[model samples]
Target chain A: MQGFALYPFDPPGDIAALRAELRAWLAVNQPQGDIVARANCWASFDADFSRALGAAGYVGMTLPTRYGGGDRHPLERYVVIEELLAAGAPVGAHWIADRQTGPLILRYGSEEQRQRYLPGIAKGELFACIGLSEPGAGSDLAAVRTTARETAEGWRINGQKIWTTGAHFSHIMLALVRTEDGSERNAGLSQLLIDLDTPGITIRPIIDMAGHHDFNEVFFDDVLVPHGALVGTRGQGWQQVTAELGLERSGPERYLSSHALLAALIDAAGADPDPAVAALIGELTAELWTLRQLSMSTAAKLAAGEDPMVEASVVKELGNAFEQDMPRRVQAIVTSGWDDADDLARLLRALLIASPSFSLRGGTREVIRGIIARGLGLR
Target chain B: MSAAREMLCDTARAVFAEAATVGMAPIDNAGFGLLLVPEEQGGFGGDWGDVNAVLQISGVLVPGLPVAALIANASLQPAAAVSLMAGAMGHSLALSIEHVNTRQQFGRPLGKFQAVQQSLAVMACEVRAVEAAAAVLAARLDAVGLDPLAADFEIAAAKLRANRAVGVVTSVAHQVHGAIGFTREYDLSRVTIPLMRWRGEHGNDAYWAQILGRQVAGFGGRGLWEALTAR
Candidate 1:
């Protein structure tokens, strides 16, 4: 339990160089669209854009060179993703695979799995989605009824996973399933890497309120996976999934979701704005700035191989609140009722619809608060 | 934590704990006022990280010290800023926790209620956020030795966060403690009153927020992100 330090956010010379290189590449190759449309940030999926990003060697940055990755520090990867999200780049296609799955595979995947999947992921040709949440088990992941029983033909899986983002397009799914029956809820659970196109698998899009097709419901009926599909040890799924959630919760993406809108709001507010507006914007900016520092500090701990699970949960919960509050604040400040065609108005409207999901995704507010309470020894 | 830093914090904690029980002044004996000054200048040659750790400990102990404010505006001669922000915030939280755990309203302790737990969780989050901001600013100061242009923005942000957190923490704490907390006789009032006063010290939330807002505006939309991630 190492105490906290103000983690340096100043990019090192090499990371600064990487940031410059990525910015230059984005300047030349980024797709043309209204900035508001791109405000969706990581949720904006573009396979071609992801391919371009991978071809440019920006994807799978933290992996080893043997796997066709940059083999850089996690801080380097952090710099890259921060830049991508700030610029409102469409990174959704390869986001999950690069951010969590690739690293996880490197840690726990077999040599065969590493050779087969990591290189593709580094190349951005392969994409993945999480399959931890089921229809009845969202925040309470231990209640997942997805069963993957072993057989002569490897393992047979039968269950459904809801709110599986990018399931329609992902090439792989890391499914948390029950492999054994036990009195303990977390016991006997295991994570299996299931290829999305396998037989007896079905995926249906669950369009969000913002009319985004980023989420899907995936079903499996006797879907057979190879015996080698299991990740880490069986019955260790609880630990592995918890670790994965740490990655999910503590990233630039956690707070940068509405960054584009904020930038636009600042632009819309103009210079020498109303006192109330200036203060509101300032408060939000201060909170956002502080949240980034907190997130970066957690990242530093992760880079140092510390769990910092409690800190990660705190960042996610607070960041979720800030992100959710952003649109309403903007709506209050910019009350002129601009035309729907205006970029700022459109982005604010988009965020208003999307804001509710900020707290709901990754973990609900209640669940995160419970985690925080437990961390503080209050429970 | 390094050996020296750990020693400094432990000494501060021990002194503050003693000061909390006795009516003695913690700063008079703790030597925290001299912690930031270099040894070559006839004071303890400690860095910002050490001072920050001590301040957080002071917060927990509610030692009613102005060590942070003294360090914040340290001159050739140490001047009192009379700010007890950290100590007050920490003390209020501690009092609330103690109150909820020992004081029962229904069939169980107050802390056993879900509402009280949620409020305390939020208060803890605010405190942790301020701690993080302070640590970040301290690290930046340690690295660059207080370049005004860079350090001012970070300092403003940290102050703003701290001021804001004190508001939430003090309010929730008093709410948890109920009417007893409002009385001067109660220990909670000792911290809560000081916190309200400290919220205006150095700079209040609104004052620092305006400064931060101006800086963010000066950076423009695209450049604002660069300015924030610059360090």
Candidate 2:
């Protein structure tokens, strides 16, 4: 309640029931279809799966039921998300909205905004994209130059957003725009939920190294929105976005991204893997558990409604490295699969192709390191 | 779990798990006390029993370093670590190094051989016995009044066990690595160097051994086994 603390990772009273229900649900509903997810990459979207999750009341789980949420704890939501992700459920479309935006609105949205947006978001009919990165402002959050000019109609937005994940498919862009053109740097920023179908907005796909159109570059051209769309006080964009990043950055997902592969690899290698493999796996497992505790602890702190920025940053920086390394080591071992009869070649091929983006996607390693240095008072 | 015991373990585990969440990673993963607060500042709250649980869990993770970190802490906590904290400015690490050098192997690091492992096994057994005795005494301390000096003695057993175990174990680990372990960033010494340094601090193996020897001398031959089973 005071300092940023964490929730307990131990199972709660209802956990056994929750686990059983969720386990059975997964068995029945493994996302397997022509358009369903293979690895549940948060950028990959499938409409039916999104709609089905909402129908099952699994969307916006931690928010209040009045807003169409299930009124669950964040940790409970974490368990659900963990299970869904591990099962490779087709949740890419709903992930951003459910994981970040719905909570953001609940925390800072006005009544009109909440009534208009949250229920649909919780129902998974509406999806959101964070429009923070730009051609010039990637990872330098404070450098956002997108201008939102005030007019009688509302705010006229004009800026270009880059690497907007799911932008091509999202219903709304929760864009951080520069308001007032104030010289306070971080002080002039504001978050605006601009409808993607707005007259002046344009979206174009950016194909990645993996040949996926999961990211995009979006342009805002005099896009008009009502004044009520501004989140919290207009001038506190920096503060609000900082809080948003904290939510995005930490938690179980940070380390669990490559866990499926880790589990598979460990099983293939068996216990007492070669000294090198065992050492690396052992190292990774220790860090994974440590990060799990740290993230869960931070979630507990946030559950008590406290800002655990430092602890969250510690988790993120460490998690970033751990996540990035898992795929690399997996690749190394899988590469050896060609020669070693004991190697699982098929699994190795999948890991070799997918693990490349491990460091770049979540948050860049460099960005996280900067946060860590600042967090440690080394800045 | 007793209410006091459960609360103590949970709170301490949560905080420690958090503090320990940070490190330089693989090289830094070999950490124990670095993450734990000092015992007197209401830190490392788990008693001898906690130490045993920690060791058991340690066996699961980095079987080698997990034990190494705990042993390192034990070495530091009692003989050298406590003394250093108490303002014992400078001291030599005899017991720590002697175990490393004198041990024999395949013309290698006794610090590097299987024979050292045998020695290390003996040391581990000693640490285990001392930890068991201390755990019982810790429960006794909880039930009775405070005896800071007796507590210090418990701390001593931990250190003696730690010093001997770390010295012997690390030497063999280093031996297995050969020359590569000598590199600065190799992660080999992530387990070895710290043990070496801490063992050298105030008292290494022999330093703590003398203390145990004196206690044994005080009770004639009965001191060794009696002090161990005193719980």
Candidate 1 segments exceeding 4 Å error: A1-13, A181-184, B13-33, B57-84, B102-106, B147-150
Displacement of residue A122 (Cα, Å) in model 1 is 0.9
Cα shift from native, residue B180, model 2 (Å): 25
The CAPRI class of candidate 2 is incorrect
Per-model CA lDDT versus the true structure: 0.80, 0.58
After superposition, which runs of candidate 2 have C-alpha atoms over 4 Å from their true positions?
A1-7, A10-12, A33-40, A182-184, A270-281, A335-356, B1-192, B195-231
Best by TM-score: 1
Candidate 2 residues B1-231, lDDT tens each?
A: 457545544544443444344422432343344333456774544443344334333322232333334434433334223221111001011222343555445665454443443333333322222233333333433434334354544454444544544544555445544576577965455435554665555555555545543443343321222233233
Report how far off residue B213 is in candidate 1 (Å): 1.2
